[model samples]
Target: MWNVPSLEEKEPELVREVEWFRLYTWTHFSPSDTCRTYGSGVVQPFNGSAFYVRSNCAFILTHFTHNRVEYDITIRRGDNGLLSEVEIIINKVRTVLQNGSILVEKKSVSLPYDHTYQHVFRYGIYTRFKSSLLPLTVTWHDVPGGIDTLWVELEKEQNSDITGLCGKFNAEAEPKCPGDLVYQDKGPAYVPSCSNPNPRFIDQENTSSCVCPDGKVLNDRADGFHCVTVSSCSCVFNGRTYLTGETRSTRCQSCLCKDGRWHCSENSCPPRCLIEGEFVTTFDGKQFAVPENVLVFWQSSMYVQVQTSFGMKIQVQVFPEIQLYITPPRNHSGVISGLCGNNNDDTTDDFTTSSGIIESSAKLFALSWSLGACSENIPNPCINTDNALKCPKNQEFSYNLLACNHTCRSLSGPDPRCNLQDAPVEGCGCPEGTHLNQENNCTPRSECECHHHGGATPPGPVVIDGQQW
Candidate 1:
């Protein structure tokens, strides 16, 4: 038979079992906190049973285990008598945080080690248990004076089972210092960071400076400052950080940010004009309100005839269907502008108004060139409604074969009345290179009958101007 311990007797045992390890020599929450003098020595341990010191050299700082996971912390002192590096080993994995900068080595792989238990934070790393058990946090302050300090916090159930430089867990044991006291001013004021890597130091100053490890610079974001490599740096535009190789498009240019700079292309969008039924888009890309009496620029009655100053004639026909024929001159390649656009081969500025200003609205631009006010809105004639004009059954629909159709009548020579520049038109006439002969049939110019005074005459020649054959 065994005697059961009462709650009163077991309380101390349970309290001793749940031990908290807050490891740090300096108790200040921040490096900039007020300074105070304590027992002399390069290294110090708080709430620990014993403290030890060694000459400028590397040595194991502490060794502990929690939940079967082993943690080893080591420190190296430089020849200048300051902490040079602090290495932490969790089980088989190792990470070295060097002094002067907060640079940590790539973590080593360790099998059978549950990586989810560890978490990396801005200032340090922490490990958590699956249950609501307290976490073990290790913080490394990389400042000049604080670099020598290693911070660790853990909760244990068995305090008596622990032993190391951290000291015995029982409160009765006094902390013993093994080295002679040497109270000195905190080391240099600051550490180097990416933004200000080479910080200027003041002699005998107690201020702390921020720093980052080698090959890294400080990157500012909305949240806070982060250290990043040079190649990984991002570009900031309009207060926004843009990753490298990102692109942005504007109205006239396409820009990409590369190497912390913006590379842009020349004007990419050409001016355009659109004049649809109820919508009009100007050359400047602005849409204008449409009027009820929107004039039809491309279509006209077949009876309408146009005579251009540049020796071009456009004749329309209403028979089989509304058709307009164009007869262009061999000369005059450019120097023309209107609804047909400037024939200069460039279509960019086709909407130049009469005032010489390129207009963005087709309605306004066309109004500038209008000879008179447009008539009342007319119903579309093409819409097949009752009372609409119908084509004769015997007559076939006529389509404009070419803008410049050569007829047999023109075979004799150019018509003086139609000696106009080239323009598109449509009319009821024979196909190109054919003439209306005596039989009223379309015949090739080579097989066409002769004409006398605008009258079709048979191949048998007739007298003309006192010349007979």
Candidate 2:
């Protein structure tokens, strides 16, 4: 049978095995049993003897050096005035534990490296690892009680090479509490963070508090608190978080969140205009109806002119009334201007004059854009009070005279003149039984005007040069 090691024989080995040790326990008690509190403590071997120190405040729990490797451990309190976070730094790498989560450099990561050994216990996880520069095995147990237990087991040759809260290994000294207790009924300590970098503290109290490593900031996230450089932090917008290099777009602009701010650029949106019936919507989005009876008169001496350009025809009339009609092409949009208004879809500045001032009065605005001098006094032709010049007794007043008074004089088959219809003007026209003749009089269809070679003649016998024909 194999012989097992006896309890007495293993006692001395177990006592000398661990160079330093610490165990944090929950000390806060609640009478109502409605709130939870956390606590902290430390235990280490000093001069071949073990001692313990306990506290409920946040402070630098321990800072020691062993075999040229530095280890720093700190306890931090939360907003609830209870110990909540634990920070550990070995060499330059930092790790934090808060709210049952582990964070390394502001990001959650799996515990127990490839070289580290891990074990799961009934209460928590236990991890152990030994770095090349450190001549001791470092072990820590994550407990459910909001505190952790740490142990440093040294090699036999490195027994007297340790210093700090564990005590100077070469001297026999009594364990003492750290003088730097922090957050004893005090306000919070504001440090640099992703959301609030370069924080300015007011009424700073003389106390020790845990901070992120050099050149890093605290990133308080939904999961837990993290320590990271400013450049690696995500941006928060509209109550949502966006990673670096993410982008968003709107109707007029495109934006990206970078370096904790929004960078935006205007979008290139072409404008459009709408002119429907009496209502005109400009390129700048101003909407209004054209005023009634405000007529713009071109000089009567100017002959009729037709110009074809931009896939559309422009017809200028200067006979009974000065009128202009432009039939724009399907693709002709956003580039036209003048009396019709800029077709750029924005109506706010449609009445801009040649002098660059936007005029408010439509009549004055139209006058400002006229190329030639207009008659100072112009009469409204539609307001004819003379009953003799009005429609015949049998006729009725029609708003759309083009359809109601179409006669042989007005019908020129397949001609451009037939397509050039006038705008609807208030006028008198013949009723169903009669049509307007070339003599400017209403008559029955049997005595209507006659058309020969697109020329119109009155229905009665005509006398030309005093000869009856």
Candidate 3:
């Protein structure tokens, strides 16, 4: 009997585990970047993370939505490799910034975790938000025994990736086209009745051993799939296997074959993009290419679904009118849209699909706005600051000039929606008799002068010094 050494008797050698650790998440697109159009959305629905894996550096981005505003977080790996920052500016006035402690590799901590937006009934979360892309930078201890610190200056977007703003991620794709691709087969699979798996497939090889064997054939059980037409009208299949019953339908039965178009059958063919114009919307700023059969709806604001080759429905809306301010204000929450798109074929609504650039290096932009909100208080038209009853300026309508007295500079801005800034126009000057007080506009003296108006006295030429004497 051959004696085999027991498992424990084997030479003891230590195997090292591959170096792996976790890093804290960092969140903030850039320190500071200018933005025009203002729009905001929740970054994370639940708890999850995104990582930027570089040569020797890896950082994790964690996010969660509270109330409606989103909170961002960052984490890095290595000894004392942890760095985190989150900043928020509301109404361009009150600001809140939080920084975390320096951490080591494989270390973790859940801070008193509260930007503390009063998400309660008395102080519910603010529904409005804004964001813009700015240059980004990161610092870490990736030096000696550490990794190389990484700094990235995100390129300014010539045109932001607006497509992602309008795009819905394609989680997975499913079947969308006909399964049976028109593939011609040979041998028994091609034979008329014999259903031969292998035969005299070559057209003129008159060999008796290969011809479609008459009577019982060794090819009776031929297997495979194919598409064939006899008399171009009645079609049949002996080896084709479908989840449902066999198909003998004519070529014209599926979809209209207008203008000699071929009948393509693949269950998962993707549709093309329908973006034709410089279509910009509140959605992502990524560029999108127009595709065939894709209906880009300028008339309607809705999602233009991209049926991928895997049957996964990825939605890319077309809002050619986003800049036009037709429906809900650009910064407001609203749906912008595009029509269905098909391939390059002349077919319009045939509903067939073609492949698209599902992945690309496209830039993304976020629109934003700032301050200036107006008060809704309508001042009494009849009363003056002196508590005196004043005669209406526009008598026919009893309209008070003071009622329209709006100060443009008084508008709280830097954020458009804040105090609701004054409208884009020059304001009114002094009233008639008052002739502009110290402010140089209108100031009512003892008797209100109607000079500017018809009743007001006109200014007579005055003698300078003693010239009149």
TM-score of each: 0.25, 0.24, 0.13
lDDT of 3 at 370: 12
Instruction: Specify the highest-lDDT model's number.
Output: 2
Clashes of 3: 86
Give the per-residue lDDT digits (tens) of candidate 3, residues 110-181: 322222331101112211122332222222222233223322222343222211111122323321111122
Give, for candidate 1, the lowest lDDT window spanning 10 residues: 176-185
Q: What's the true lDDT of residue 392 in model 1? A: 25
Candidate of highest TM-score: 1
Candidate 2 displacement at residue 229 in angstroms: 57
Better of 1 and 3 by TM-score: 1
Model 1 deviation from the true structure expressed as Cα RMSD, one decimal place: 30.2
List residue ranges in candidate 1 displaced over 4 A. Answer: 1-54, 99-117, 124-134, 144-146, 156-160, 169-469
Writing each residue's lDDT as its tens digit, candidate 1 over 1-469 gives: 1122222443443422221111234545322211111211233333422222323445555565666767666666555445566666676556666534332246443322334435444532322112122234565444454354455555344333433334233435432211121112232233333334456855535321233345555453323335566556566666677787898875567778765567789777676454322335577556554543332122211344445545565656554555566655449675676666666656678888887888877777777777888854444558333533333222222444332323344455544333323344443445445554322356766686654453455556677767895
